[model samples]
Target: MLVSLTREKFEQIIPLIATGAQYAYYWGKWQDLLNRLLISVVAVVVILILDVVLGQGAQALILLLGVIAGLYWLWSPIYWASLRNNQYRRFPYSGFWRGRILEIFLTEDLIGEEETVNQRGDLVINEIRERRINLVIGDETGFEIELQAPLQRLYKAIAPGQIAELLVLSRQPNLAKIDKFTDAYIPSLNLWIGEYPYLQRDVFAEVSRQLGSDRSRANLNKNRVRKPPMK
Candidate 1:
């Protein structure tokens, strides 16, 4: 069954979801900071080498810049972490809901690739493929939610027309976070099938086990309906 929330319920849950989103936002920022720090370190090293070779007398200037960058690099994560902790303190409850994917699409965007040194000190060329995703989700009550997310793990796992469960911070409507796809009934096959390929075996096993029970056997035989297996 599709799990939904009313506006009152939605208001209550928004903060929970917002906390999750806030953390995710800060995490992305942290990553960007780390990348920038790495680049700054490399630049500092290059500048020092140039100073030594060219005798440019700019070593002090380069060193100062490096120190400032390093300080900011160390401070950024701590600042964001504290902020996240403070916000999450207000929304401590967690809950889940079931919804169906109504639509899914992506828009491609170019991102600058960063150069990194591996353990062996060799430069690794990384190409960034950034994409923005738009997902339209509908609950059993016909309430639709539209989300824009980075093309990341959860976004890649789900598709249009699939049923999914989301974990949200309780009392926070805006914080609906994708948990996983759920098995759905296939009227054509008279069987339950997983929305995701990796979950097929587990879903099948659970459903078969449920049908095997004497209590559920009769119900299974009568209507042959299946519910999404709990994780």
Candidate 2:
């Protein structure tokens, strides 16, 4: 009888749970694009060869198939790469769009190290720190906005166990840039929201048995605790 209720509970909160998982998954995915790039390149070449071998009449069809596959493989890494590299292509934020809804987790509790900054001319930009920021989000992609901005001050002042909420703006992307910080990107499911609450090494081990979020099931299992998992 308890099992039935447990399943029901999982179902009821599945949306939120899925959101957390997605964030966790994509966050890593954004970093995995490098490994996948070579594969994507090979796939494109193979598709082109097959299209030519099949015949000219089917050239358009094969080309279409190749393009679709190429796009599917490239979108995430491309998007993340573009965003990370482009200073102007900042993550979309509430001020940029309106009416869009989102959930935010205050991971200040999971603080790592303080980020340093240098004044270049007059702009205040981060000087690349050794800490990892755990910012997760759940979004209905169809909404007008493309990039959802991080809650800046809150993220800066995050503490353990702090959770918050915010509304996002509605806007469409006219152009986007690649991120230079990361080397690759991957795609993820929509269940990372709840998973993150336990991803902290201290928290993960303590609640592993309770949440079934053990290393065996984690999408990110390389890290043991303080150190980052292999990138």
For candidate 1, what is the lDDT?
Answer: 0.51
Per-prediction TM-score to the true structure, in the order listed: 0.36, 0.28
Q: lDDT by residue for model 1 over 97-117, one digit each (tens)?
A: 446679877877656787999
Off by over 4 Å in 1: 1-31, 34-75, 92-94, 107-130, 152-157, 169-231
RMSD of each: 14.2, 21.7
lDDT of 2 by residue, 1-231 (tens): 001112222223222222333334444654366555666678788888897788787878887877766765545534443333233223331111112223333322332344545665554534332223343323344332222222343334433223222221112323132121111011111111222221222222223233334435563656546767888
Output the number of the TM-score-best candidate: 1
TM for candidate 2 is 0.28
Off by over 4 Å in 2: 1-9, 15-31, 74-231
